[model samples]
Target: MNILFVADPLEQFKIYKDTTFSMMREAQRRGHEISACEPRDLGWQTGQPVTGQVRDIRLTGNADVWFTETPRRLAPLHGFDAVVMRKDPPFDAEYIYATHLLGQAEREGAAVVNRPASLREHPEKLAVMEFQQFTAPTLVTRDPAAVRAFHAEHRDIILKPLDGMGGMGIFRVREDGLNLGSITETLNKDGAETIMVQRFVPEIAAGDKRILIIAGEPVPFVLARIPQGSEVRGNLAAGGKGVAQPLSPRNREIAEAVGSALAPRGLLLIGLDVIGDYVTEINVTSPTCFQEITEQTGFDVPAMFVDALEAEVARGN
Candidate 1:
């Protein structure tokens, strides 16, 4: 099988931690072909088949410089047996445009992981509203007044932009609310943008657990990203320490509830962000933690992902 990964620059991958690279390695182990390109490389001029100017590469067992370039060319996404939309997201306008291109590829019968439409329909920060019972009290609003009110109500809350990733632009407003107005203004852009405000989950001290669901089935272990000193964000990018552990019953419950509903909608993979027992985020755009979980739990996460990818491709055929 041939797999084309729509992702960040191949040269920039931290192979030790990047989930996309891990997936590529696993696929290569199974004798599948792999190539990569950033979303910017995708193009769909009038006469093209929703094409991407990608670099074909094969993975090597190197701790550094893990991939060797084979060739570079413009090809229709449908030429590949599976198209993995593994681009990490701010979910900005460009990302949305890329999805439309990928959606076009899907229409042309290429199997795209995490269906393009589902990526558009379910923004990570906002998708939790679909499973309110499993999520913390969250408010999505642009109004500074509403934000202030929520801050007052919850006493301790987290405010972040709708388009943020890897804990960027996140703030915690405590009861005293030292910087509430300024933070609200910055995040909302004077009532011009929407943001999410959720009551701060105290259990974050333990860890913010990332539970991965593949093909509507939960991975048995989760990578619990524990925040470093004086940080509230448990994102590994934010310098959190990842600890892999078997998923608790509540974690399984959330994954099962959310996965069962999303799988039929073409979401081949999902990452559920659980704070305590509540789901705070549903990361569909390139959900990660493959290396961490595998290194600690002895679970072959990337191999499992490749297995699911192969199944989806065959099913589509």
Candidate 2:
């Protein structure tokens, strides 16, 4: 089987902890051919199949440089057995356009990991709104008065932009409500942008747990990113300390419910972000944590992912 990864530039990857790299390694172990391309490498013409300028990559065991790409050439996406969309987010206009191209490739009979329509339909932050049973008290609004009202009701609240990743632009307005107005202004952009406001879950002191689910099943272990020092964010990108641990019963319950609900939506891989018992986000675009959990708990998260992908590919065929 040949697998084409549509992700960020190969040069920018941190192989030691990168989940996509882990997937590639496991795929190679199974004797599958691996290919690489960025979203920009994809294009479509009237007469051509939705195509990408891709390179066949052979992995060497070198730590600093793990992969060597063969000469790049144009290939239709449908030529590959599976196409993995591993691009990181701020799912802006360009990302949406890239999905449009990938959607075209799907029409050409390629097995794209995340069904492109679901990706467009399920924005991570907004995805939680539908599953209120497992989520924290949350609000989506652009009006300052509404945010102020939510803040007044829940005193300690979190305010964040709709499109931010890695904890950027997230503000915690304490009971005192200091600078609440200003925080709302910055996040909502004075009524022009919509922002999410949720009652702050104090269990954040425990950790922001990332539970990886494959094909609607939960992995037994998770990467709990505990905030360090005075940091309010528990994202690994925001300097949170990652601790791999077995999922609690509550964790599994939430995973079973949420993961099953999303699997048929064309979301093969998902990361459910749990701050305490409440789910904070549902990540479908690029749900990570394979390396962090596997290296510590020996869970073989990437292998599970590849297993799901392989099954999906076979089913598609």
lDDT of 2 by residue, 1-317 (tens): 99999999999999999989999999999999999999999999998899999989989989988899889999999999999999999888888999999999999999898989889999999999879999989999888999889988999999999788888998999999999998888878778999999999999998999999999999999889999999999999999999998999999999999988999989999999999999999999988889999999987898899999999988887
Whole-model lDDT values for every prediction: 0.91, 0.93
- Backbone clashes under 3 angstroms, per model: 0, 0
Using all chains and alpha carbons, the TM-scores for the candidates as numbered come to 0.98, 0.98
lDDT tens digits, residue span 1-317, model 1: 99999998887888889899888888998898888888999988786688888888977798776778966898899999999998988899999999999999999888898899999999999999999998888899988888888888899999999888899999998999999999999989989889999999999999999999999999999999999999999999999999999988888988999999998899989999998999999999999999999999899998888889888888888
Q: What is the lDDT of candidate 2?
A: 0.93
